[model samples]
Target: MGSIEDRLRAVEDQLAIADLRGRYCHLLDGRQWPAFIDLFTEDGVFEGLSAVRGRAALTEFFAHRVPAMTEEFWHFCSNGTVVLEGDRASGRISMEYLSVMNGVSYVSAGHYDDEMVKRDGVWRFAARRLTFYFLAPLHEGWAGRPFHNPAA
Candidate 1:
């Protein structure tokens, strides 16, 4: 068994990991892709509603998807838990997203299963997988628009 101080250090390390996850969501919401990418390791794999591998893939995915719609979108992440094993860690985060497109709105609620690693005193995401719980569409006009793949 570890000493009390060791346990406390583990708890603190988990908190720091959670804080980094929150910052990632904040940067994404703010459209700061470069800054957001910095949170992940170079070979990171981001898989979720969309699967993006590596920093370059993530950057391309964000560039192609985020700008196609209206700019009114907000993403909130909460209810996260982090588990650490030496230099590697994993976490799950609940996410809520709301967006307005061409005056119409939509919302999605989901959770992200994430894998992280500590390298040279910095924490970075090694992988992330998103699972959606529910999605609700708002406004009637959204149905009229032709379906366009955001990733395209």
Candidate 2:
């Protein structure tokens, strides 16, 4: 059996992992590309509906996709479970993303599979695979209008 101190340390590590996941969502919704990139390990892979590898590639990927959306966006995460093993850990988090475009709102629900590692005393995501369960289609003619500029 693990000692009390060991158990407490494990819980703390899991809580930190959860906090990192939440920060990731916040960075994405806010379009804070640099901050988002900082969350990943140098060799991290981000596989969305489209696969992107490395931080630079992920930046380009976001540049192309995020601006195209004509909406204010929010991503909410729930039911996160983390398993830690020394320097390595894995997690699963359920999520829902909501966006409002031209007075219409759309939502997408999904799950994220994550792998992480502790590097130099800081935890960073080594890989993340986002699997979306459902995505509501945008109403027609929504793209023709100006960008929603959520940051505005």
Candidate 3:
């Protein structure tokens, strides 16, 4: 068993990881591209359908993509479950992406799966994966497009 000091450090690491994920959602929705790029490790990867490698590439990737929806949407991430091992960790979060189009609200259920690491004493994403379940109008919700990934 680890000592009390080790256990305390683990708890602190977990909190930092949670904060890191929250910042990701905030920066992405706010379209703070520069700050968003800093959220990842220098060699970090963002893996959706394709992969964007490194902070510079990630910046360029989102710069072209995020602004289009900046005024229309934001992400709410919930129920983050994290597993930590020393300076490395992994997490899964349930994301409710809300958007308003033509006065109609639409929501999508998805998962943000992450692999993170602590570098220079700060936690940053090493790799992040996004899997979206469905996009549905508010009235319809996820009833017809339920999320069913056992691995998550």
lDDT (Cα, 0-100) at 26 in candidate 1? 86
Candidate 2 has what TM-score? 0.82
1-152 per-residue lDDT for model 3 (tens digits): 69999999999999999899999989888878889899999999998745899988898778875444334778999999999988999989998887775566777878989999998899999999999897767786677775432112
lDDT of 1 by residue, 1-152 (tens): 79999888787778779778888878887889899988889998887647888899989877656656545778799889887898899878899877776666776677889899988888889998878665455543343343333422
Model 2 stretches astray by more than 4 angstroms: 100-104, 138-152
**What TM-score fits each model?**
0.83, 0.82, 0.85
Residue ranges of candidate 1 with Cα displaced over 4 Å: 139-152
Worst 10 residues of 3 by lDDT: 143-152
Worst 10 residues of 2 by lDDT: 143-152
RMSD of each: 4.0, 6.2, 4.4
**What's the true lDDT of residue 113 in model 1?**
93
Supply the global lDDT for candidate 1: 0.78
Model 2 C-alpha lDDT per residue in residues 68-135, reported as the tens digit of each score: 65457788999998889988899899988777766677666788999999888778899999887755
